[model samples]
Target chain A: MQQVFGNKKAIAVFVLPTLILFIVVGFLPIVQSVYYSLLEWDGFGKGKFVGFALYQDLFVNDTYGIKFLNSVWNTFYLAILSVCVQLPFAFFLAHVLARGIKGEKFYRTFFFIPVTISSAVIGLLFLSVLNPNYGVLNIVLDQLGLGSWKHDWLTEDKTALSSIFLPAVWQWVGYYMLLMYAAIKGISEDLFEAAKIDGASGWRMTFSIVIPLIAPIIKVCVIFAVIGSLKFFDLTFIMTNGAPQPATDVPSTLMYNAIFRRNMYGYGSVMAVFMVLECLLVYFALQRLFRSREEEVAR
Target chain B: MISALRTKWSNVVLQFFLIAFAVVQLYPLVWLVLTSFKTNLEITGSNVIGLPSKWMFENYKYVWVGSDLARNFANSLWYTAITVVASGLLASMVSYAVTRMKWKLSKLVLLIIMSGLMIPVHATLLPLFIILRDVHLLNTPWALIVPYTVNAIPTAMFILVGFFSALPRELEEASVVDGCSIYQVFFRIMLPLVKPALVSISIFTFLSAWNELMFANTFINKSSLMTITVAINSLRGLHTTEYGPIAAGMVIATLPTILMYIFLSDKVQKSIVAGAIKG
Candidate 1:
């Protein structure tokens, strides 16, 4: 039985299809993206090799006036908000719900409904609600005597990017909440019982016991939020399509426009490559940051 | 007495907060449903938040029958179905091999597959587009199918591996000692034991494939081959200010998953949590 199961051929047969597909569809494309980033081509014609000029143009030149750096900044801006605002809100909800609140199941399901729905649908839902002319938001604001605060949420450059962040944060707070809630639920009840017997205040108990124990899951949620923000495309694409002079452009949308719209495959590939590297760098930095803090806590 | 009063007050406040937050979370969807039933005049009226004075069901009929939504719906259904089954089976096999089978390179193989999770789909668009064009699958459902299955493998495997690793070894050993072949042991004995994980992975994959927009938008240009997402996106482009049919289109696109979540919320939540912690 061991011999048959351990046969080299059997192992290859089982594992190779997925591995090959992963390489072909996942790994090779990334390597090819890097290679393509180094060339000048229209994606169909014969390419001429230009060394790192595209990367420099991405940073320095405004030849296309696409604001590559602005898109990068926008992506990071969303990532920061995700980490700061979304994570805390999610964590707070999870922390509260983990106390075995009544109708916890109902609340959990209700909150996560948005997560299951497609981003495109959510984008449309919000677009209708935020439309400048007939949007419910501006109408409500007028009734509440806050009409001065209303503007073209998706059109005007001042509010377009910030407007998108609301839906972005809305869609996923419940998702991260569920993650942290699950982690918190896994904590042993005995610790809470002991803390109660010791007369620990509820706030103190949560701050010290619950928060510390769920720190690892919190890190996971942070990484998810950061990466999710970096790759945020669907909502922005469907909602605004990077309109009003690229005000709400993220890297993924920028990459899409470059390749598909402008036929600048090399420039698009550079954005893709940059996204991959940024994700890796942020992931490792997060790991190191969390690991060092864990060590400090242990000491 | 003061402490007890404080507890009661806090509980009321907390409940209010939770309920309020839930309202904020769900109001947009409720508004969407209501607006879908309203006339364009009603939607564009000064009273944007009011119930439709007359619920018009024609918007739904227009969206369902007037457009290519029905065909696109079929495309989304079949694409998601194929992706879920193929990816689930492949991922389960690889997971079983990596977790149970004693192979020297199992860890490396697992690493290679799992690393696919980090590569954003956008990064692969250009080359994928070119490859599909070369293979004459640019407008075919296969373009979406192949990438969907490939990209879904990591998350599916991540869930399956945890389940596979936790399965008791005695059952496999007993089956083997009874002259059952390795294939029989796997197919007949092992696969059923991990049904829960497989179900969760299928749900996750189905939701993702159903919601997939970028690939569908990029690869499939013809209205005949467009998924519901891409189809609805086109609908948006054509009917930019036509709120009723547009809202109806979104409801059509979103209803299946929303209903699925309603029934299988537990399994979905468990899968998400398990995938997060384990992956």
Candidate 2:
């Protein structure tokens, strides 16, 4: 203990700056936000203290109630849909590429390029491409004699959600696929050669041998996917601006709107607090579920 | 013979399906590049997928001269480079001490640094804004650069720590014995060994800092201080629209990033695939 404590000077010199910066810039806001949740501050005025009433109203009021519910739904939508839509294809493609499939590098780059672009840019690009009349998608439909398939994808209620969801899936499928590909390569090659000699077919081999061996990575990917799902913004905000009413609002957008646009600092803080808590809940739930699944598979 | 042909046909079908999915993924980007050449009216008119009848490179011309996008791009570039260097070195220093030095407080410091990862950027915005304001950093480069470097420390440290942990102890010990102080050992011996991890963290740090919107939106006020993402978003007012210059601005904002990704494409693929396990 004494010997460990002897290096206090070295430790303090290394750690103090980041610690101090995080304390002032990060932690204090969380504490202040909780405190602000009890007050009525419109960003810049002296106001009365309103304790927990804001919380009660945010939870119970019918006007904001549906919006809040929709926000939660949007979170779940991105989390669940993206994982389901992206993972199966990403895993197979990754497996093929990792095993030195033809043109592997080009395929990987094509998929992963979207991940590098800002979500804001992707949102804008898609908005133009999905424009009801002049958009490229509609043009494609016309060329193919399937004009009926075309719609104002972003603005119309029937297609707005899918429009945003599809773009998110498109931009990121490569990113996750790359991660999966890496994990696949890391798996020992001797195992695969052994499986081939045992007369196991490729399809069965992938499901049982490959999937179970890389389960840990897939678990981490899901956790990362879940958090990303719940907190996504940029696309919905810039693409539609919660347009056609509250059709595409997520919690982050709602929190941002409440704080900046509506000038409801206290109310916004409550939403912000809930968002943090909601993320934790989803994260742990997935972790527990996956961890147990691993144990079950092991047993 | 008929059955054999059927089996061969099935393999081709499966391969084609994978190729089709890859095509769909790459299309939106192809769309982005093509639309940048079309006129505003042309883009907004019929035939979203049709070929541009007349390519007006004017969009690029208008976006470059008409707005503050060029300045914003420069700001993002400057911030990304400065933050990557500052935070990268700072993280390496901290990781060196924590992993090599015999200190109880170093572990505590490591824990605090790691915790910064889970603290959402939004949660930090308000307090950080006030802190920047207090320091007279509002609308200044300090607001963007300082907050960015501070935010990047955790991930930089985490990667570097993981790197330094996996290093053999004998080399570091030999450096210490060769009349090298801790600082010399860190710089001369330990630093050169962790190049891959450092590059990986640096790319991620630079990318996040360059592309972030909320923090830039909240803390920065001067139009001069705007980033590429922020300036592009602000082009249109609440009522009036300016799609032409906006798309142009979007393309300009995109070029640097595309260039960086292209040049470092192999490095990025290597970085992420290397299984950077922590933040």
Highest DockQ, which number? Answer: 1
Assign candidate 2 its CAPRI class.
medium
Error of 2 at B192 (Å): 1.7
Q: What is the TM-score of chain B in candidate 2?
A: 0.91
True-vs-predicted CA distance for residue B135, candidate 1, Å: 0.8
Q: Report lDDT (Cα) of residue B213, candidate 1.
A: 87
lDDT of each: 0.89, 0.77
lDDT score of model 2?
A: 0.77
Instruction: Give DockQ: model 2.
Output: 0.50
What candidate 1 gets wrong by more than 4 Å, as runs, is none
Best by TM-score: 1
Name model 2 segments beyond 4 Å from true.
A1-7, A62-66, B1-11, B46-55, B238-244, B274-276
